[model samples]
Target: MDERIRHLGFGHPWLRGGPGAGDGGETSRLPWLSSLLLAVLVLVGTGFAAEGQPDREPLDVFARLLLLAGPALLLLRYRRPVVCVLGVALSVLVYLGAGYPYGPVLITVAVAVFAAIVSGHRRAAWWAIGLLWAGHLLVVHLLYRHLPPSGDAAASWWPEVGVAAWVAAVLVGSELVGMRRERWAHDRRERAAAETRRADEERLRIARELHDVLAHSLSVIHVQAGVGLALLDSDPEQARTALTTVKAASKEALGEVRQVLDTLRTSGAAPRAPAPGLDRLPELAEQAAGAGLAVELAYDGERVPLAPGADLAAFRIVQEALTNVVRHSGSRTARVRVGYGTDRLTLRIDDTGPATGDEAGGSGNGLAGMRERAAALGGAIEAGPRPDGGFRVRASLPLTPKETP
Candidate 1:
């Protein structure tokens, strides 16, 4: 049965019987049970009222049956509230015209009105209420027109007052429930949007990390491979050394790539190798030298410890800067200077002007990635053609730890 319902596109969890079946079943059953119970009460109350008024005409079989069916019709209220309201109202009018004693059929009408309001049919609810009131007034006028004026006018008016109060309560209660449901739905939508934004930010962070890790290593490999090919026959020893450099750089790049993949496979739970930092700048410069660029590292002031993120960002900045020197500057020599200050660390990389006029103006992802790394740490970077006819990349990053407390 559950499979069939699902196949028919009625497969809401609330409809499928399983772990939460009890709750769903109870919810589905409660309204029907309550409507049935109200119908029984209406039947018993009307019987007592008819018994109390000995002078009232006994209802014919058809009228009595219709009065009893009024509340039963309320079972449809949840699915077809408007129809139920109209059906019950019409039944009440027929029963009353048959000279039967009034019963508690109005309870079902109240339930129908509440159902319609909560179902987002406020306009229809109002129409139903108006029609019911008009019918009630018509019945009252027709039934009491030929009767003599009674002394206790308040007693006769009490039923009308009670009916108005019941209707008002139903409408107000339904509106409150509708408002609560709307608020719940809005909260769910907000939570979903927040999760999507978080996922997007995480993806962008990984992409940036991969770009930084692979770009510099690949650039070195490209240079070394070219050198190996050029000297393969003439200077086999030098060519083998170049090939060795290529192998080592490729191996290190693969390890870093594997670490990144492991982090992703484990959903970032795996232990990661230590990230490269300023301390690795010497090795990075050596790799640049092997790639045919003579690189020098210079430091000013005493060495200061940096926050881990800041250290990594500084290293990447230098790595990318050296890469640009090798690929774009066409410079044979480059200088990297690190300065430790009172509250921050600054790095500068400058390359001798291009070897020839043709290689002066090509820029790519290296500079942009370097800039992003610096800016992410509340730092700034400047990269452009230098006044002395070379290219310079300068970055200043704060030494402040991310978690001070």
Candidate 2:
């Protein structure tokens, strides 16, 4: 085959946009310019090669049409690969058997075979190529005397070795290309699936954050509003203080909510305020106190800096546990113990006595959110009724940081 013709056919657009080429195995359009260029090259190349093979039959009208048939058939390769390959192979075989000059006419078969394989018609492509090879064998060894170019004698068997090698090379190279394309498609699907999972996890995290922020603040506001309403007639001064607590709680809640929203608004900008951590424990306790649940804090060891993810998780776990106590427990006090070890941070929150209502467990997402937070940080959260009396929530968090997804 002419090198230029081979190059042109190999670079054709049909090869890249064939079936299963990332367009979901659908043929969207035709490669008109490439097909025309290939057809022209095949015709011109064969005409030139015929001059070098004066002993063979000269280029005639029917012979030129056979050279053009392969490229014309390839227009349907993506949609009808089997038919296209069969048609192209048949035309090439007929041209070969007719004693016409051999040149880039083989390029047509190459293009058709490649397109068929790329479109996932490997068996059809193999059959087509195999048919061409067998037909060449018959024409060269058994039927040459009865064919055109009357005085031609039988060709040597050694060239058959090169032909076999060429066939093997074509099949091997086409199979390699097809395998690579399949791998590329698999990688694309994996990346897409991973991105979807990350999106879902991010959404769940945002929902959990919103729930914690609103649950704790709203619970406090609900209690303070009740206090303000009840003490309005009895003690105006206490009622004013209760209203003040409500105002402060609502304001803080708004700030936190805005911070969360800011993260969404800004793609990668820094947060307006730092995430809450153990340093804000006193503030958390004060808010719980405002809601009529007095909190006691006990520190067991020295505090150290923590990774941002672990710090945030620790803070949220405590906040959610305290909120649970405020909503469910009959006891008015909660004891929060913080132990700072070399590699771990332990937190224990307990409330004395039984629960307030019949449904003491408090059917809410607070506990589940805490568990998720701890688990995300490679930590664990345990919550249940104490054997003695009250409810207890214990969490163990690692000091090591985790990569942000």
Clashes of each: 0, 0
Clashing pairs in 1: none
Residue-level lDDT of model 1, residues 77-103, one tens digit each, is: 555555555567677766654556765
lDDT of 2 by residue, 59-120 (tens): 88999888888888878776666678888999999999999998998887888888778766
The candidate that wins on lDDT is: 2
Instruction: Provide the RMSD of all predictions against the true structure, rounded to 1 decimal.
Output: 8.4, 6.6
Candidate lDDT scores, in order, read 0.73, 0.85
Worst 10 residues of 2 by lDDT: 8-17
Error in Å for residue 66 of model 2: 2.9
RMSD in Å for candidate 2, one decimal? 6.6
Q: What TM-score does each of the candidates earn?
A: 0.68, 0.83
